[model samples]
Target: MSTPVEQAFRDHWGRVLAALIGFLGDFERAEEAAQEAFAIAAERWPRDGAPDHPAAWLLTTGRNRAINRIRRERALAAKLPLLEPPRPQADQPAIPDERLELIFTCCHPALAVEAQVALTLRTLGGLTTEQIARAFLVPEATMAQRLVRAKRKVKAAGIPFRVPEGETLRERLGGVLAVVYLIFNAGYSAPPAQGELAAEAIRLGRALAELLPAEAEAHGLLALMVLHDARHDARVREGELVLLADQDRSLWDAERLAEGRALLERALALGGRGPYVVQAAIAALHAQDPPDWPQLAALYGELARLTGSPVVELNRAIAVAEAEGPAAGLALADALPLERFHYLHATRGELLGRLGRDAEARDAYRRALALVHDDAERRLLERRLAALG
Candidate 1:
């Protein structure tokens, strides 16, 4: 079992790094300094006992270490003249929370979407380059280069290390939320053996919601994550994927589901009708016994209109099937331009099987099996194909 101090380090690593970056105004330097501080903590905490406020201690230590390193490097000192050492003083006022600022900076529109997501996972989510690369199915060196380039652009282009306001915040908020969802999806879709990217994303979502409590979309995103992750325990069994309907409902986290419902209610009350809110509402419907599939289909239709996403439409088709019949769902799925999407084919296969078109269903399942990446999903498809005989 990990010690409390060790757990605190894992939880607050991003916060400490964000604070250091704000103080030092250099991404690489801040990360290095934060790492050094944690290294020191590893050595000293066992001897000195853990501090009452580990995050604050880590931030202060990281800042001091950064200042000293700058002092020692004459070239670095010349480059960063504004980073003069702080004078010893009595308890200073608390540093403002800079994690939001850091995330906004990472998700700047100037960066590509992939880079923005990768950088956010690294800087704000505290994921290593290798871990992020693995999550995205990219090579380690490629991810490392991507992070390097992102940081270089941030420095060279002088992206402001502060949160935007008004219209700017509105424009940038979408990218940040997209990146968070991407992180969650990565964790949600990965094999059971991988890390919990979903939990990390949910934690980040909670932080974003707390930081911008008035932002309905933030709450919506958090609700969506909480609702989806509540099913994490039920999503798989015996190392195989388990469809939602087939999952043992008892395995679902009741507290998380309740929390998600409360968040959805709060978001709706805030007059949020955005895509995330709509999706969360759909998830809320699913949590119900004898789900309101008509309402779910309607919400998905609204989401499809808001986002113009074929995936949402495909989901809507599934809802339509549940509300109407498999044939209606198959018709909707057939019209979609998702030939390469494995889930689309898998869904079609199920609908076809339900309609007793075994031959077509078997072919559809084969197509899905060919395109599917996850072994568990592929196995499910294979089983469906075999059932056709």
Candidate 2:
């Protein structure tokens, strides 16, 4: 029921903001100008009708607004030394799509991981501070401060607002991929309240994949997200969480699954077998009916080796349980230092339950319930605990 103008604004806000930041070379000023342009559009669009290229219109308006604001406020003007006048109509493209540069800037290695994720969601994902905070289960005020500090750091450090090249790009690409996947996971794991975030993250991933088609990890990340998102419908049922093995396959999105498979194939074809690619391959295996557990276990072994992540080892334990036995899986799980991760406990509970170690399983489920924050996941752990009784 949303209007075309609303839809356009939602879709193009990041591109407009990215172009503005590239032009203005100041995040605060660029954001303010972009917001002002949107405000004007909110008033004018209903009357003038939406423009053929709404993003282009927004970029032009935002640039003009920044120029006017700079001229009016001397104090503000001093901070920005290189304000260029609005280019003549024929001299410039409608809107320069510099989102890649914007993403790299937001995901700079100098920034903390949390700040990188927050700033990328805000600037490139067009997510509100409140939305980002809610997604991460943090306070709005705290998230706002984090964003402010990150922006100030970018300016103070003079982090270039352009994409890096050669080895530099390779060095920075990991951070960028991590930020994108974090956004996707935030959206994927939360309940319906933040479902749109998952879709937004996927859109960002698709854009990244298209922009850097040669990068195997980019394609791997996109495939991983798409494959995982394909199960969104099956992940929940009648307001309750559904375990993967119990999910109704009919509810899984076929198109998204196919898309993910195709992307995985492409990434593999590129001969890039990074952690993301291996993870995507694991996800693809899971999408199968009676998933190839032996293959999944092998892939998880590769993944754990690639990332040296205890979480991946925990996942590998699950696959090992299926391919071998619950006792074997429990042995592997016990070796991991995953005391703080809720899923580890949950997996341990499931494995112990399968092995008829009900008392230990009950204890694991209780621990998981205490650690888990999500309502659905807590409910699931409680259900498991109740089943033991």
Candidate 3:
């Protein structure tokens, strides 16, 4: 249902913006110019037809817009030094994919981790402030302020707009990987055909793995995403959510699964035992004909110890329920400090239902329904609640 211009925007927004940033060396100005270019494209492309190379056209248009703006503000132009434009090369990509550099700049340790992830989503993932805000479950105004502060910090601290080298790369890599994974999670959680964020995240993961071929976590992250994404088609059916246990395995993408397994093998071969590697190993096990519940519970326990996150503990509880029993999982879940998290209640509901505690299960399901927002999830919870009667 999207116009050609809108489709082009979705495909090339990040690349065009990255090129503009590399040219103008200012995030605000680069964004302004990119918007201007897209605005122009929306108007003109509809009538005149899209250019042969949309990205190249957009980048050139944005660059010219920036130059024109500088010319108009003579005092500002005089006060600020600009890089000389690089000569055009025939062999160069239409719009150079400088997103890696942009992401590194956004994820610099100088900024807070939340800001780093938010800023990367904005600048390199082409996500709107509202989209990023919703992903983080924060108000739009709060997210706007956070983004403003992050950009200001980047400018004030003069974070270099280039990928780091040597020890610095190793130091910054964790933040970058985390940002990419969060982006993936946001996309993965969305309803089917809602956005290209998951594919975009996988693309970024591929870039990271290629950029750091020896970095086991990079490969692990890529493997993790691909493995999970392989089940995208089977995750939903007939406009309803599908649990992994009930999903049609025939719907899963074999190619992606194979690629994921190969990548996991590569990561393990490289001595990966980090959080991502552990998660990748878990995902691989999930793909098996019959999952190893005991081994899975053990791996989740290891992950819980490595991350010390309550959410990870919650996942471990579920695995324990499968490996041990519902009472065991309920015992662990009841002690967690995640009173406000709906998933905890949802998990309790499922485990309680399995144990034939109808009344308690209904209460937990209702509690989850109260907190849940997504239509697909809400419907699932409602069905489960009704089944108790």
Candidate 4:
């Protein structure tokens, strides 16, 4: 349908605009130029047939439009340079390659964590302001203002518009990967049941992996997302959550599972050790063709040792449940500040359910239900409570 085509066009527009802005060193003018380029495409593509390299066409046309506009504006009125004394015509900033420089500038560490994530989504990730706002639970107006401020800061700070070399490349790449994983996590942890989790996460994950093929952890993270997402259908009942223990294994996406395994295999081959690699290793065990409970348990243990995070501990508890018993998982779950997160109690309830502690399980479910804001999560917890009743 035209909807998919329109969506694709918008996605390309954002990417090309961002790339061209990186090229021109003028964020404000980029969208106008990209739009003009698209207007040409819309007329030409339908009549003369689509071009061979449509994206490249868009980028080239947009840059040309930007240059023409700059020339026209300059001809209209002579303006003094704000940053420096009048420069010789020969002394001008060199335009860097678009895509690489764009990535580096957006990933700059000076921005707040939230701003960095938002900028990447707005630029390379090709997501709309509304989509980004909803994802972060911020008001659309607030997000718009935040983005405006971020762009202004980018211009004012005179952030270098080029990819770094060596040590600098390593540092910038860390922020880049962090943003990708942040987006992935946002999509992955969507209620752990339903409402467009896998599809949304996979969309961004695929983008990240494609954008940075040499970055092994990116592939590993995508594999991890794919592996977990493959279980979406099996993750819940009709509308209620079916714990990992009770999930129907037959319902898992076998094709996705295979893809995830293959991706992890590639990641392991690359041998880039990082948080993502470790997480992928944990996910890899869950996605084993046969689902090796003991191996999966061991992987979680290793992950906990590396991260030492309470969230990881909570996850490790789930893995321990498969290897040892519910009592062990419950004991592990109990040793932390689980009240801050509803999932912690939800998981504890599942382990308690397995331990034949129906009353305690019911209590855990009730507590979790109270903390949950989503309707589906509330319904799931109610169903669990009713089962206990």
Estimate the overall C-alpha local distance difference test score of candidate 3.
0.87
Off by over 4 Å in 2: 74-85, 90-94, 339-345, 356-375, 385-389
Deviation in Å, model 1, residue 382 alpha carbon: 2.1
Which lDDT values do the candidates have, in the order given?
0.88, 0.89, 0.87, 0.73
Q: Per-residue CA lDDT of candidate 2, range 134-194, in tens?
A: 9888999999999999999999999999889999998899889988888788788777788
Model 1 pairs in collision: none
| lDDT of each residue in 1-389, candidate 1, tens digit only | 99866797668987888988888898999999988988999999989898777887777888888877876876674756676555442254355479998999999999998999889889888888998898888999999999999999999999999999999898889889998998888888887534468878998999999998988999999999999999888988998888888889999899999999999998998999998889899888998888999888899899999999999999999999999999898899999999999999999999999999888888898899889987777788888788788
Q: Candidate 3, 84: how far from true, in Å?
A: 3.4
The order by descending lDDT is 2, 1, 3, 4
Using Cα atoms with residue i matched to residue i, what is each candidate's TM-score against the true structure? 0.92, 0.90, 0.77, 0.82
Q: lDDT value for candidate 2?
A: 0.89
Per-residue C-alpha lDDT of model 4 across residues 337-381, encoded as one tens digit per residue: 767799898998888888888898888888898899988778878
Worst ten-residue run, lDDT, model 2? Answer: 85-94
Looking at model 3, the pairs that clash are none
Badly placed stretches (over 4 Å) of model 3 are 1-16, 32-72, 75-82, 88-97, 109-118, 127-150, 165-168, 192-194, 327-331, 352-375
Clashes of each: 0, 0, 0, 0
- Cα lDDT of model 3 by residue, 1-389, tens digit: 99988888877887789878888888998999999999999999989998878888888888888888887887565634665664563244456778778888988888998898788778776778998787677999999999999988888889999988898887788889988888788789886443466887897798789867899999999999999999998998998999888989999999999999999999999999999999999999898888898899899999999999999899889988988999999999999999888889999999999999999999999999889988999999898889889
Better of 2 and 4 by lDDT: 2
TM-score, model 2 to reference: 0.90
